[model samples]
Target: MTEIINFRAGRYKISFHILHILMTEKYENNATQVPSSDDTLLGVINYQKVPTPIYDLTRILEGSSAQQQMSDLIDLLHEREKDHVEWLNALQSSIETGTEFTKARDPHQCAFGKWYDSFKSENEDLKHILQKFDEPHKVIHSLADKLLKMAATEGKEQALKVLNQQRKSTLRLLLNLFSAAREAVSSSYKPVIVYTTLNGATPSLGFLVDSVDDALTIDESDIQSFVNDQAIKFAGELNLPRMISGLITKDDVNSLLIDPSLIDASLPEAYENEASLA
Candidate 1:
């Protein structure tokens, strides 16, 4: 059996031996930069009075990672919220001017509905919160047709009153649900950096990650080393970082195992120097 610490970086769960982790702390924008073409090198930051190289693993991986995805999802929810606000405005205009309702009548056919239908996640809490949105959203959309008919028959005053009532009740519920869902995800999306050293020397490197997940114990059999796999170096693809020694499969999730010394050796020359303050 072996012990490893798992950290989330974008879509991946990456790990290193627990001993390699000197400490983990929330990331700060304190890095000092040098002129460098490598985007992976996020400059150097101060750590316990020693200059440490700060690297963004997401950049090492790609642009699409957990942190970026979380940010985008939050933006998506806000956009959906805006859509409904406009829907309500357009609805009021339709009622006042006898204009035909311009928004879709079917809840499932609307923009937010379509996105909600396609959204997938393992987060049960988020799933539950979003599911609450369905009935209220449907009710809000269903109001247009019914309220318009009421306007023509019983006069606009009563219809507008019903519309405002629904906004206060159903719309209020849906918006609260949105806020809850956003908070749930955002709470867990906090990013941190795992501070590491070369052996027990200076705190030489800091890995910026989406979040630190868990400490895991697994059989040695769960690991597969691919550092020397030439197939990965085939023409269009870049060589796998020597520091990323292997993959460890636990509970069907595959995470990369990082080799600290080799990762230090792999640093771009730009990160070689300590910050002037150090």
Candidate 2:
């Protein structure tokens, strides 16, 4: 028998070997900023001032192509809204007789224009879709400020409790945002982030999940090799990059067992090779 950390992702009850789980931490704001190229690489988090890259495992499991499409859609929407605001401002200035408004190429090619075209075809309400972007950034910031004050005056334990509570609230708000975006685009997928270390390193990485369930032990007899499954093998080849080592069955549902070392493989070649030697 082997111990495992069970977590929920979509409708699946997934488990990782206990050895693979370094620790679990609350998701922080500094960790989730958008990255440059890789859609799965959400952003880096500071662990004791060491920057660590975070990966969206849910995106990887669902396949990168689909996630990329959704990410593009969201990006398009945000860009369109910004362009719309600028256009409206320009229109207002022209109406005030400041200057003549110059039309920028075809409006249909613009972000809002494209979104509007799709919205009309889909027959979804534009107001509701736009409203989904209203986030609680102010509330989150205020809570963060309060947390810092508590840390300075109340002490570590009390400040940690406050921080955890605030994190839960912030996570809930984030989930709402993600859920709203998915709903606006008619997608059913929902992703969450779990903080853990790769190969027992200092700075931890975040794994995108659907939801977290529980931690428990499993019988070793239930572990099965993934070598026979072509689909999983291919996923390992393309996305996870030698990450999936085996599968574990729990409640008749089989979940992939990931190797932490393979996650470390995502690092630069020099770092990965050094870590391997270490």
Candidate 3:
């Protein structure tokens, strides 16, 4: 028998757990980049004797449309594990007795050879001895399974950790250093770019304009009015979740706030009373 299920998303209400799955997946820059179909998948995982989708929220947020693609990624991970074991065992024996980079076939193999040589030169005899029985394939498979479990158990916390560890401020320094490089590419180009972040996630926008202009700030009350106008139009056209209260622009970034009244909303249901920012 088919059972009906429903969920909340912002102010919009949805029947499919698809919205919940997407919510678990983090979106980049208003859903601009699609996520790579890798990691453990939902849908095929059997729990309590029933098949359940084991979704990686990050991929969903990146706009992965097919569950089968995600399943394929999981299978690929297993295959890689098998290959990793063979490579590690091969590397260990070659390194213990002294492997030669000259005999390596590919760049990756050559790099590994160089690493082993460097390790041997540093008098790391223990590492050299340990390399022979490394059983790298087994480790890779174990790590993959652990990662899948972490994604399933921790959810948003794991997502936040992934975002925080990966987003680097060094990109900002590189951008400033290479400003001249942009002009050298095209003499007629006058480009302006906006660098912003969402919860420590790096986001960028480019604007090609003639010249710089003054910046302005608007009051929160006025912004709310603007959001209401856009929300009315968005709701009509998109058929987005009824739980979506409306699109709101806060702290220079726009987020679709979920309605407090909706039962299926993914946004936090609890709130704490705070006195002031100061």
Candidate 4:
């Protein structure tokens, strides 16, 4: 088995060999400004009395130009859906009798159908939301389905509990998704900085991360090399240095294994010079 340190970057969970880890700490210092030539270089932080350049992991993995266009469009769709759902519920409540509530013409074809139909048209866009649902979306969607089922068969209070939980979950997920998407699209993206050594070198370097997670020792057999895969070859077209060497599977989830040394040569000349002098 190979020991690795797992960490979160944006929505991704990635791992690196524990041997490459120099030290982990809560980022509390502001990095000194650097020239704007390299977009990957975030800034420089003082490490062991030597200035170390901080690189943005997200920006390096996903290019700065990556469009969150799909995410924005999905948000619009969700907002419209929320409004429509609220309207439908209100309309149903206004129908004095249970029979009227049940007898009410199809909302999509009634006198106010145009209002309902508009939302229906927008629903088509949801198919484009995301081919694969992220954790947040999956949880929210699952809770919503359960909420509807419970409301129909179980007590109102019981359903309300599920609804409340969903509301909280939705809010948190929205914030996380929005922040991650924003970072992907924003011109000025600043993430949390981490300090570590390149191949256990003397001078430590700082790199940006979304957040830090637990460390784990994964089985070496679980790691699959990316050497000859067509997809990995296509990833190389992006011209990223030392991006991902292999993927580690733990608990059925795959995490990319990043080696700091892979990107050491890609650091700015000034940073390289500073490391050499140190």
lDDT values, one for every candidate: 0.78, 0.54, 0.29, 0.54
The regions of model 1 sitting more than 4 angstroms off are 64-72, 120-128, 152-155, 227-241, 273-278
Question: At residue 148, what lDDT does model 3 achieve?
Answer: 36
Model 4 stretches with alpha carbons more than 4 Å out: 64-191, 199-201, 228-241, 268-278
What's each prediction's TM-score? 0.81, 0.46, 0.22, 0.51
- Write model 3 residue lDDT over 1-278, tens digit each, in one string: 11112222222222211122112222222222212232312223222332222322223233332234334433543443344434434433333333431233332343333443443211133334325423421232233333334445776356335423322332222233233322332232222222212222322111111112222232434133223333443211112244444444435544343332241232222210110110
Give me the displacement of residue 189 in model 3, in angstroms: 48
Please report the candidate that would top TM-score against the real structure: 1
lDDT score, candidate 3, position 121: 17
Give per-candidate clash totals.
2, 0, 26, 0
lDDT of 2 by residue, 1-278 (tens): 78887765533456677766665664444564532455556666655555656666655665553346556666765565455445544544443443555534344555544555555312134346544433443344344345445555776467566655644675456446545655665443334555555546564555766545666677877888766344543222224635667778777877877766666655545433332332
Model 4 lDDT per residue over 1-278, tens place:
78887776645677778887776665554777665566666567767776777766656666541124334534654564454345335433432222223222333343223432343211222323222224444444344345445656785567666555655666455454444433433422224556667657554667667556767877778898756343532121223434568878888988888767765654556656544553
Model 4, C-alpha of 248: deviation from truth (Å): 0.9
TM-score order, best first, reads 1, 4, 2, 3
Candidate 2 collision pairs = none
Best by lDDT: 1
Candidates 1 and 4 compared: the better one by lDDT is 1
Against the correct fold, how does model 2 do in TM-score? 0.46
What local lDDT score does residue 115 receive in model 1, on the 0 to 100 scale? 95
